[model samples]
Target: MKPLKTIIVMLLLLSISTYNCNAQDVKADVEKMHQLYIEMINNSNLENIDKLYTANASIRNSDATMINGLENIKNQYKATFDSGTFTISLETTDVSQLDDNHMFVSGTFVYSKTDEPKGVLKGEFVNTLKNVNGDWKILKSYRYLETTDNASIINSVYELFSKGDIPAVLALMDDEIVWNEAESNSLADGNPYIGPDAVLNGVFARIGERYKSFTLKDVKLHEMSNNQVLATLHYVLEMKNGKTYTIQAAHHWTLKDGKIVGFQQYADTKKLADSEKI
Candidate 1:
């Protein structure tokens, strides 16, 4: 009886060891697939790109554009390589085993053109890979470019404003923009300021006339779903009476066609108004 019990214990240990070995093998295969993907991109060759994806794989571009199927994916790569010379570097940040035959990987990538040395673009991506037969291929790829794009547009607005380029800032807005100022704030008097002209005349002009210096500080932008962006910032308003007001503020913006179409402001109105006192 004691001999039989010892044999059973030995068998259990072997099974556990085998399971661990299989997990390690899966990890190595997944890592190899990622390396192959990077190699295909760096090579800038469409022929090798086809080998990295399944027949029905889908890819989402940074600007929220979707490419479906292997043929279209090949075309996208062909267009990119044909456009100009660029090199991409990807660093894996996280990897998760979804199942015995699937994996999820996310990482940041940096891309730069050989000619445009100063024009480097960095973006993030998430990919899902499936084990087909004995090899792994990308099943779905989502690139987080919308975040960068929306942040860029918002930053440009602030830059233009700082440079006193009101016209340029207005140009970035839609023809029929819906701009809402914080409730109870002086600017809110013209709530839902429609159009670029209305925004310039109602909001900007009023602020210029009221405050000696109106500046935004510590600004942060967050990208949300459905083409929305949220900005958290602080307002530093210097009154003509030698008084100053610092108030927390937030701005919500909705954009389309590379133009801002909607804006909503949130701020401490009472704090801003009190600064007007001598």
Candidate 2:
């Protein structure tokens, strides 16, 4: 028999060795699981869904909707594949063991349409995984899409406009958007354009026809409370009659769920009007 102190030391070393082996195993298993998910998404393999998630698993979608149960998760993935062919890549950032039978994983993912490789969306996901028998299955998952702050959203509108991407600008507006032009401004004739289509026709189209060039200059955006953004800028415009004008302008934008829901403009309308005269 070994001495008492030697026996104790051997037991301690064995325990540490066991723990280190388990840690390595869990890390490799996590990587393999994420790789499997990517393969399932890229291949649209519905048959393998059972191996990925538990029976009562739930998902909290980025849009704030909750999908419960494995059947719904399967259906959701099916719909995703039906919409378009997409390729997904997942990167596991952290994997922590919650116990001998559970794990917490956090990772980032990027998805791109197979046809449009340049258009990709990146997001983050947190997943709770349960070890059932000898397999790991996700129990609860939550995902968030890449988001822009209020000021950034408002700033992007200007950038997109500068690049002549009118459709992209309109895409950021809510379906029931309410737009208001400066009170004395000629475009205000159609005050409170009720929708994107209305604003496009009543304000944007009219401006295009009336001005040889209309551009915003020295623009600054301020993020305000209550989901509003304030933009202080100047307009550098040339009228069709060869008259040019520079005027100060301010825009107050209200957004909801990342979409522009309301807009108000404040500017020197007198100069805008005067510039129209030859």
Candidate 3:
């Protein structure tokens, strides 16, 4: 009963509304896929993982192993979960809805073993998801086991230090790294060292001069949001004065572009002071 122009306008508006709704639906479905994948990995729920993939899905693991089909993927996950107690953390860096039925997602994945809390496996991954029966299911996945992000960079610093590669450790730091030593400790005399050169001169030089040996033990790195890393470690120092000290310490590192820009130290300074005179 409406005029032809009014009918055409109504149809156009309806089409636009439908397109918007479909776009929103696609985004929601893709996000759900990410959430369910993370949940399954963190919980080690292999059964649910199987359901998340298509029957003919293919996955290329970071280790270069190729797995095909839902069964094989489930078996792979089961074996991994059985081999160790671990938790997986995921962060989606980018996502694109290729079409209404397909989505592409890329993200960072980190796996931490419970027994070896300090050791972590980090990687970047891309997944192709397809809408299957109104659900987003992974059609193909590829993972690369290398990360150049802030967390990985900071972790490398500790790894280098553990290996006594001080130069390599220092190389990962910013030229103007703001290094802070724990208050009340002998090293705190420098307070905030402004540059890597200052840190090497004021902090590391002092430690080397005063201690027979200084090492970090039981180091655990936690990747937090916003380019921050938390390191829990113990400083085992043998003073040149024939005394050994073990102090619990924490380092909060802020990083940008794979370089440590800021560092703050927190420790049992009273214990450190007590050990100094002993």
lDDT value, residue 20 of candidate 2:
94
Cα RMSD for candidate 3?
Answer: 13.6
Tens-digit lDDT track for model 1 on 1-278? 57998999999999999988886887787678767767777777666766689999999987679999999999998888887787887878887888877889888888766665544567788999888887888999998742447778988898889888998899888769999998988778888999999999999998899889999889999988877899999999888877788999999999874679999999888897777555
Question: After aligning candidate 2 to the native by TM-score, how far in Å is the CA of 233 from where it should be?
Answer: 2.8
Give, for candidate 2, the lowest lDDT window spanning 10 residues.
112-121
Ranking by lDDT: 2, 1, 3
lDDT of 3: 0.82
The model with the greater TM-score, 2 or 3, is: 2
Tell me each candidate's RMSD, in Å, in order.
9.6, 4.3, 13.6
Which of the two candidates, 1 or 2, achieves a greater TM-score against the reference? Answer: 2
Candidate 2 overall Cα lDDT vs. reference? 0.88
Best by lDDT: 2
Stretches off by above 4 angstroms in model 1 are 1-12, 146-278
The TM-score obtained by model 1 is 0.52
Encode model 2's per-residue lDDT on 1-278: one tens digit a residue. 89999999999999999999998999999888888898898998887789999999999997779999999999999998987788989988998999989999999998877864434667899999999888999999998977658788899899998887888888788769999999988889898899889999998888888889888899999999978999999999987776678999999999865779999999998887887665
TM-score of each: 0.52, 0.73, 0.49
In model 2, the Cα lDDT at residue 194 comes to: 97
Deviation (Å) of 83 in candidate 1:
1.0
Position 35, candidate 2: lDDT: 81
lDDT of 3 by residue, 66-87 (tens): 9999888888888988877777
